[model samples]
Target: MLPLGGSHAVAEGQAVLLVAHADVTTQRLTRDTTRAIFAMRQRTWPDGQAARVFVLPNDNPVHERFVKERLAVYPHQLQLAWDRMVFSGTGQAPDRVRHQAEMLERIATTPGAMGYLEREYLDDRIQVISMD
Candidate 1:
């Protein structure tokens, strides 16, 4: 399981998890697919529901750790990818949440919404997704 409960999630080495709305059927995603989803390249879940991506600010430590450890890319690289997509008019950026609380609340309330969170913040309202 992804580590949780530390005050400073990433700085203390407790990486956050990729989470989704409780009703979302997708329990596992390939790393490439997860990356695509956050990159806003994949528009729908494999189950065919439109995916709504949520993210903490790029400068957030949880966001940085998630990008590097889980997605295998730097935060700036991901930002650049999003920027290019936005500028090229091929896609838009993920919905940005102000903090982990907002990230959890947004994902829990929005159908097909997905985001990352420290495991301490997890509850039944959202489900954790595993990446291969």
Candidate 2:
């Protein structure tokens, strides 16, 4: 089986659990939807919720790899897209957290924020959505 802690599982056809600050939930996102959200390509979901995102700090290789391999995009590319969006006043990038612990803490405390971690760290405080 995959490692145990960081990820979440979302039932099919249900709203993907977005664990961010209350203000951030305005942007509800799915795993596929988040690729565009993070890439700054799609600004909002069909429901008109602005896509709010949470990210790992630059030094976190696990998150970087997740984005690069799973999302099929590189960190620099994601950053560049965000820069372009911000420059054009189209959209902004997701907020960044320091590490998995901080990410989990923030997600648990916040309402609409969504992020990822290894499968081993999950707890009762937040909901974990399965990607597939």
Candidate 3:
């Protein structure tokens, strides 16, 4: 878990960047598509490439901020959605990494990957997908 009160510090213009493997062709995502992919309802990008989603633990400050600020959904609500999809056998849960470093590594190496991170963690190895 992140330190107490750490999430408050993320409010100063630190929007989450939606990043993917550099080779992925898709460059942008609609708000509804982003929501569905993160919710474990959408398995592929609009261009028909597989969407590989990564995330930190639910209790992590970054995860909380990304869901609430970027997705406009609460953590618990997203968790419930994932659970429903997994149980119904219609979808699988996103890959879970322990921290931002691991998330960055996974996104950089995995093809079709998608994950959110702070601007400081981004690099040329990953392509930033604009949220439309």
Candidate 4:
């Protein structure tokens, strides 16, 4: 579990929560499904809505924590997968946001969007997605 009250980049530990647009029908996802979506392998939610994935920079600590702790992979591995998908024309990378604020704004406004956030950064504009 992520600890409470941290800095923007996470201070020691993170309670990064997977979040989605307020109107999304799906409330929970399995780890594999979440990983596939973020890895650019899954294109739609279980309810059949197109999945719009958002991500932070490869070097961001929050991203590192989310990728490693939640997704069970290193940041570089995810990046390499994205690079291969882009170069081979098999797939594309997620929409890259600058920070949590922008990630919140984009996911809040865009339908079928999904991303991660520090617990304190969450607002009613988005819905917290539970990992099933």
Candidate 5:
């Protein structure tokens, strides 16, 4: 088992969650911007390119970790925000994938796509976005 607070622990990685996309840009996103993107509040990156956000189900552990640790928000809060956005016609929810492989596939193929992943599941197809 992974050691408590180990270098590989999910919690530890969650704090510095790797946000990757298919684009070649070396843009490092600010924390607020990252939060805005995931919260569906921001539609474009700093470069003005449309940002396509992907995510796993709300109940998934990695999803929970990402929301809580990376975004500094709770899953339920994010869900409520998403609901408000969709119902208000101001924004739409992110594309959802069932697992890491699917998330990887979507982000790697889709343009301006962004999503968080554990380091081990990461590969070359996706470009990492650093959080400011």
Candidate 6:
């Protein structure tokens, strides 16, 4: 079993939850690919699907730490990358959700929505993607 309240516990296929205002295209991403996509590196899938990322609020410690340690990128770097994309009119950053529950709800309803969540919280409506 994975430990609680630490970065190690969140691994591949563990269902990372994301939230938005009820519209976005993203769901069930590989852990490494998700990390890359979130960092704004991998823009499209091998199948030619556009990668859409949804992120939690910056203030959330879990979100911050995950990006820092797992992605090996700072939040400011993510912002800068996103800003650059926006300025260039390439693609904007993923939408944001207000809270975990909201993220779950929005991701559940939205097609192609991808997000992370604790494995314990997963349900039938949400499909967990393996980070392994």
The C-alpha RMSD of each candidate to the native structure, in angstroms, is 3.5, 7.0, 5.4, 3.7, 3.4, 5.5
Please write out the lDDT profile of model 2 over residues 1-74, one tens digit for every residue: 54333544433212222344434423334567668766767766445655456788655775666676557677
TM-score for each predicted model, relative to the true structure = 0.90, 0.67, 0.88, 0.90, 0.86, 0.67
Model 1 residue runs over 4 Å out of place are 1-11
Clashing pairs in 5: none
lDDT of residue 68 for candidate 5: 79
**Separate clash counts for every candidate:** 0, 25, 0, 1, 0, 20
Using lDDT, rank the candidates from best to worst.
4, 1, 3, 5, 2, 6
Best by lDDT: 4
Candidate 1 Cα deviation (angstroms), residue 2: 10
Which lDDT value does model 3 have at 107? 96
lDDT of 6 by residue, 7-108 (tens): 344444342333222233343446577667786677664355654556778776656765766566787888888889989998777778776666677667
lDDT of each model, Cα atoms only? 0.89, 0.62, 0.87, 0.90, 0.80, 0.61
Per-residue error (Å), model 5, residue 102: 0.2
Predicted candidate 3 versus true structure: per-residue lDDT over 1-132, tens digit per residue: 444232344554466778899988998888789999999788898889898999999998888888887788999999999899889998788999999999999999999999999878998899888876
Q: Any runs in candidate 3 off by more than 4 Å, and if so which?
A: 1-13
Model 4 scores worst on lDDT over the 10 consecutive residues at 1-10
Of 3 and 5, the candidate ranking higher by TM-score: 3
Per-residue lDDT over 16-94 for candidate 1, one digit per residue giving the tens place of the 0 to 100 score = 7899998899999998999999888899999999999999999998998888878999888888989999999989999
Which portions of model 4 show Cα errors greater than 4 Å? Answer: 1-11
Model 1 Cα RMSD, 1 decimal: 3.5
Model 5: per-residue lDDT, tens digit, 48-127? 88889999999888899888777889999999999999999998999999998898888889888898787678888887
Error of 6 at 12 (Å): 19
